[model samples]
Target: MNKQPQGNIFHTPEMFRVFDQTKGHKSTLWAVVDNDNCPLALLLPVHVTLMNGLLRQLTTRAIAYGSILSVPGTAGQTALALLLQTYKREAKGTALFTELRNLSDLGQPQTLLNDNGFAYEGHLNYLINLNRPAEELLQSIGQRTRKKIRKGLRDGFVQMSEATTLAELEHWYEILQKTYSNAQVPLADRSLFMAAFNELYPKGMAKFLLAQVNGVTAACSIELPYKNVIYGWYGGSDRAYSDYLPNEMLIWHILEWGANNGYGIYDFGGAGKPDEEYGVRDFKAKFGGDLVNFGRNVYVHNPSLLKLSKRGYEVYRRFFIR
Candidate 1:
């Protein structure tokens, strides 16, 4: 259980480490407001991944995964001031700012961060409320796309729960690896996915869904069901199944499964880059889901430092990511 201290908001390294694993960042720095005893507020740098040629980072309520919890009195601004007190103290340092992506207000750290010297970098987010009826939703889809989904249903693809055991996570892992291989992108640690899955499965917090053809796993998805909403967090499909419309069909099945199972909303997770809606935006719009402007945050030491940091990030990504 999470232990809360008296009045001080103490930050725990365990929480920050979890964020690091989920975000897949190379370097991270952490801070918390505490009276030297209990842990209250949580703060850490996410996406400290090499970007433009600088040490870039974003600090938020829970900078790990998508949604993280914070202490009752902790706020973004509160976390920022404490964070800045350390980084800013490093004399001759350039301004350091972070762009928090795909975050909506449920424990927002922005209001407080801005108070301490953070600034609104820009809007970065998307939300698919699982509160609408399937009929209302299907009616909104483009006629052509709707036909594809119907065709998928007519096909033999079926959804099955794949969270019966740790072995079940293996199937999901294979799908994730295939996705990365197809895109030539770096794959995150499978063990991390397992830890998350094992921890949340029983609580019904998340589940792994599979679509098979001839009993062979062709497509799979990892979804998180929390509160009244179900998030289509992660999933991948075989391109060969594209002809069968596996992606659309799998999603349709997920929606149907959620509705019948008592879930109200099905979040399609974030689309593309959090700030802009170009490609992924159009994709989600095809589902007839409404666009939601999500809140984001940026914390920096100052202007000069921020500029220098950007330059550093450019060089870093070029050497590391590219």
Candidate 2:
């Protein structure tokens, strides 16, 4: 699957192991192979069950990051169609919905996806090219963002470094937990990140970076690096240090590190739906990356249940999130 152009970290064996070992996450793989047993197409979706008790069933959903990985042309499309059919049959009633997050252009296979019951939705993402000179990359940044980064560095208010120990990773995770808790959003358990650190960090498939202010961790980000692309997976900051622009510095540090290390692209994970008003999207846009609408394909097994689940989530957020 790594040989395929669209293959991403989420579709790899390493990530599958991360999800499988993580609490509340169930990883599944479906593939189409040739007579000689060569893989023609592959799909790896992880069912994430959040919250507890009855809410877990409602919030459980599958996410296929980077969508279907397949060979080019008609044969590949045929294989993908077959794989989708088999996967849909097995996935029915397993979750509220299965979302295929497309990282690259699916091209003609999108029709096959629609035919297989997945409906398309418009989504957006930012991609910063890292295969350029460090100066060129810096010059491309939006003027305002560049100023904030410069001011933070010039004043020595924030320091950026990669987390090198388990404790450091945990510290970073604490910031992420607080950020999600404040936003009333569901975050995966710490076991997921611990697994990634244990399994992927040593292999250079993962990186944990920290931004510190006055020797205290103020912001953090976890990046999944596969092939030539560094995917920005999770990140958050201590809002108390917002004046120091820790988030901006953290992102700049990642970009600089990637550009200096021969990485080709930094995928800004996601930018929310195009039709929605997302503050994070506006924040990400200031970093000077090309915005792309790769979109997403969703197959909801039970629409009425999904609606109920949405309402249940609102209650969960209002009462149980803290």
Query: Residue 44 in model 2: shift from native, Å?
Result: 0.8
lDDT of 2 by residue, 1-322 (tens): 6577787888888889999999999999889999988888888889888865867778899988768888898878889989998888887888999999999888988888999889999999999999999879988999988977877778987987888898888888899999999888888899999999988999999989899999998999999888999999999989998988889988998899899999999999999999899999999999899999989999998899899988988887899898
In terms of lDDT, which candidate is strongest? 2
lDDT of 1 by residue, 138-195 (tens): 6666687788877666665644556577787887788878876675555566755765
Best by TM-score: 2
* Candidate 2 TM-score, C-alpha based: 0.97
How many angstroms is residue 67 displaced in model 2 relative to the true structure, after the best TM-score fit? 1.2
Which ten-residue region of model 1 has the weakest summed lDDT? 1-10
Over 4 Å off, model 2:
51-56
Model 2 weakest lDDT span, ten residues long? 50-59
In candidate 2, position 104 carries an lDDT of 85
